[model samples]
Target: MAGARGAAALERDDPRRYGVNALETLLEGLVDYAGLFPPAALPMDDAVRNYAAYRVGERRGMLARFVLPVARLDEFVRAASRIDRGGDIGPWPLSVLAGPIDASVVAAFNREHGARWVIDSIEAKATTVGEVNAVAAAYGGLIVYVEIPVDADPAELVHAIGAAHLRAKIRTGGVTPEAFPAPAAVLRFLAECVQRQVPFKATAGLHHPLRGEYPLTYAPDAERGTMYGFLNVFLAATLLHAGTEPASLVELLEERDPAAIVADAHGISWRGLHASAAQVAQARSRFAGSFGSCSFEEPVQDLAALRLLPPRL
Candidate 1:
């Protein structure tokens, strides 16, 4: 089981490496880290929609995963095109989490129209394993599993999500400081997912560089929420599952700034970025190689050009 999970983690394509709170992080990460793109949540209101459009337009070649309420597909499709008026950003991939409606309808729409999209079925709550499998079989393109907040064990979530045919997005932490999963615990959880052969992505709470003591800030959307540094979460997963050590992971996070972190070629430095880059590249090279097909270089090139890390050799 463990070996299978490791292989799965190493095998999945284009595991999105970054999530942002406001457009600032989104834009900054894109401009600075080439591969990092913001998964902007779809806003129900027109004012918020305009803001999202502005961000998307400015960050062309960056992938945008827009979340929409299942019922608002028509509005989402319309808004999505308008946001990409120059046709540079997208037909941005649309993602729908589990809700009241049958997920197949969304899949059917994408299939018929050749739309780029993904569907996340929140586990232990609105969606079931069968539902996730059915949707993955139907859509086949960019299926993700969302593990929502609850008392359920991460192991169970990993096993269940792994069993399904779709790819997975494991949310070990969120905006709330209390909600952040322990680094060791997250490592264990990721290891389990790796063992199960589940390919996943993460969302929310990760804004900083590493795990440890720090002042927490509230999320814009939620009053009580706070986000962690991106380095902390990303490094933890890489160390535990990517064959790096806790000590090395700590070294990368301990750097004073992004520049220092990006400079160290030997220590967890710029080489760290390649861990994700190589994993993504291999996944696409083996599985699919078309435009909509998954590839790590897309994000890696973006990140390299952005100077998020030393240029990829």
Candidate 2:
């Protein structure tokens, strides 16, 4: 697979972006907008419009790159041009989903649109060490994350990723109950990544901030299923990075009660376990990165409802 290089340096989160002191360190650029994917599965124009709006929105600080397929770069350029006529809404960053690796396509897109747009990262799958090595070698100049299966041990694949100096990705949930990984499986993935000194990002089925039963989709009759919370995933990863025990990590991921969790200026705590604000910031910036979400509003709304966010945010 061919890939391009060049992602701007990661910027530290400004304190003013989110007023919630407790969550400010954990949530900066925590969401990568993936509106084009399933569940939401928005049309291209609508997705482009939504991302452009988010770039200038109040909670923009919480948002990260726009996620799109590499093949749709042309379509994105056209749509982005139409929506942001003054070029005021860009230079938009993107994390392109890769299919067959074509170096020229990605490189050409960056050459033409690098000023107003950037292909900062690429996300692809690698079920084996060889695949991980190939992806790391091909995308050496850019930030690359390899998605590995979590049904079994991911130690070798994760180790390969760490050795390649790249990152890992996990699929946390989907449209059905079966789509969500068991809490133990998620815990294992986090533990592996932490032990191997590998950072990871997650995608799919993480719209809400807390784990609970929710409608699978937007349809009126959409069946509901238990979904893992973004807070749960990140917090667990943060704790895992800080040397918290595995048993405690599993409880954090499986915890559903909003009252059982606490987020304040000092830190975030679940039950009696605690991770200080400095620890949260370090874990997020180093080991645990952002997750891809189909709907940005859902997360923001959910956090506001939990009073984890300021009223104006």
Total backbone clashes of model 1? 23
Q: Can you write out model 1's per-residue Cα lDDT over 1-313, one digit (the tens) per residue?
A: 0011111222222334212111122222221111112222324445224434433343332333444446666665565446434433223344454432445676666665444333322212324555544544544444455453333446665566666554555454543457666545555555565567665556554433433443333235444433334544444444445555544554443333445433222224344443444332333222211111011233334345446533212
Question: How do the residues 1-313 of candidate 2 rate in per-residue lDDT, one tens digit apiece?
Answer: 0011123433333333233465666777888999999899998999999987776677866788899988888888888878843434336778998733755677778888888888878898998888887787677577788899999988898999899998999999988878888999999999999999898999998999898889988889999998999999998998888789887777778777778878877778888888877677678768888899999989998988987764433
Ten contiguous residues minimizing lDDT sum, candidate 1: 1-10
lDDT measured at residue 161 in model 2 versus the true structure, 0 to 100: 89
RMSD in order of candidates: 9.7, 4.0
What is the Å distance of residue 289 in model 1 from its true position? 17
Q: Which one wins on lDDT? A: 2
| Candidate number achieving the greatest TM-score relative to the actual structure | 2
Candidate 2: global Cα-lDDT?
0.81
User: What TM-score would every model get versus the actual structure?
Assistant: 0.57, 0.91
